[model samples]
Target: MKSPTQIINRELKAKKKCQGNPTKKYFKELIDYYINIKTLNEFCFAFLKIKITAKIAIFYFF
Candidate 1:
């Protein structure tokens, strides 16, 4: 198995390579790697609910 040090070194090398602006493809790849369809949908729904609730609260107070 790879040692912890080896894994860290590999990640550090990748970090250095990412110092420049990332391309659109790389950005999308990173997003896809980190988030799945379900999670993205949950985030969007939660955001919309918050905005709608805030608008209602403002309307009631005004």
Candidate 2:
């Protein structure tokens, strides 16, 4: 038979292990999503800048 202290220690260890894993996975997914969105925003801004510059150059030269 297990002593009361041993049972409490086992329960505590189980709870600690459970608590550690889910938050790490959740934050990793959130970071990945943020990075993807940031990269997409940057790409869109660069494309617009290039397009506007080309239009202005064409208008001025022709």
Candidate 2 Cα misplacement greater than 4 A, ranges: 1-38
Model 1 clash tally, residue pairs: 0
Task: Give the local distance difference test score of model 2.
Answer: 0.48
Q: Per-residue alpha-carbon lDDT of model 1 for 1-62, expressed as tens digits?
A: 33446534743554466656334333343344334434665556545644564576468656
What residue runs in model 1 are displaced by over 4 Å at the alpha carbon?
A: 1-38
lDDT per residue (tens digit) for residues 1-62 in model 2: 33446534743554465565534443344334334443565546435644564576468656
RMSD of each: 13.3, 23.7
How far out, in Å, is residue 61 in model 2? 1.1
Q: TM-scores across all candidates?
A: 0.37, 0.37
